[model samples]
Target: MVHTHAGFAVAGRPTRTRRSAVALAVALLAVAALLVLSGCSSKPDVVPSADAASVDVAATVTVKDMTFTPATVTVKPGQAVTWIFDDGVVEHDVVAADGSFVSELMTQGSYTHVFTEAGTVNYSCSPHPRMVGVVVVE
Candidate 1:
């Protein structure tokens, strides 16, 4: 059957502008869906440094497998605490929540911080914030 607009004979379909609008709407919806999905997806995996596996454990906190081993440590005031990145396949860093100390991007070896103030100090790897640890100085 033929379609009509304003009593005029036309094809049995919508106008070009109407079709284009539908197509544009579909395309926009698809783009929006992709954007939402991309935000929900997992983040990129962390890669270990070249010398990560061979480091000694001189640190009180150890970062491995995207986790902080021995997540909490207790010590007396003025005692020194250290953090070592022992994960062979992930890079990490340490930062105190209270601006007390910060470590360089550590993939191996240790970073030492002496706690002089008596309080609880919480820290996490900057690259992997989920990897959290704490130190209690009494």
Candidate 2:
């Protein structure tokens, strides 16, 4: 027994209620983790067209040295464009000029965009406006 400031006897051990609460909390955490893990996928799902023998070209851009590589890229109207972030230190993002698309802040990974219309799409990094790129959907 431990004496409290008010001179009351306090058991210095876990009570039955406390033990049950701890066990319940742990069980809830485990269930939440299982739910999250169940939704994890191993790879990106890519659907291939059955009519076309060749797959549509997917454009890729590289972000390095605070600049968008190639700066300008042309792709077919149904093609997908992916941006790969090569810089690991500074953060960057891609936002279209006409509010078409926007990417989350990226450090070192990739983001993709598909051009469905035949037009020129200009994009720039929101944090660094000087770094710009263009996508010409033809």
Q: Whole-model lDDT, candidate 1?
A: 0.72
lDDT of 1 by residue, 1-138 (tens): 767796444965776667788899999999999997876643333332223234332337778888887899887775677676788857787778886777777678777776777899898777677888998888
Q: Lowest summed-lDDT stretch of 10 residues in model 2?
A: 44-53
* Model 2 lDDT, full chain set: 0.77
Best of the candidates, lDDT: 2
Give the Cα-based TM-score of candidate 1 against the true structure.
0.59
Q: TM-scores of the models, in the given order?
A: 0.59, 0.59
Q: Lowest summed lDDT over 10 consecutive residues: which window, candidate 1?
A: 43-52
Clashes of each: 1, 0
**Residues 23-97, model 2: lDDT tens digits:** 999999999999988866332232222222243646778999999998999999888777888887899878888
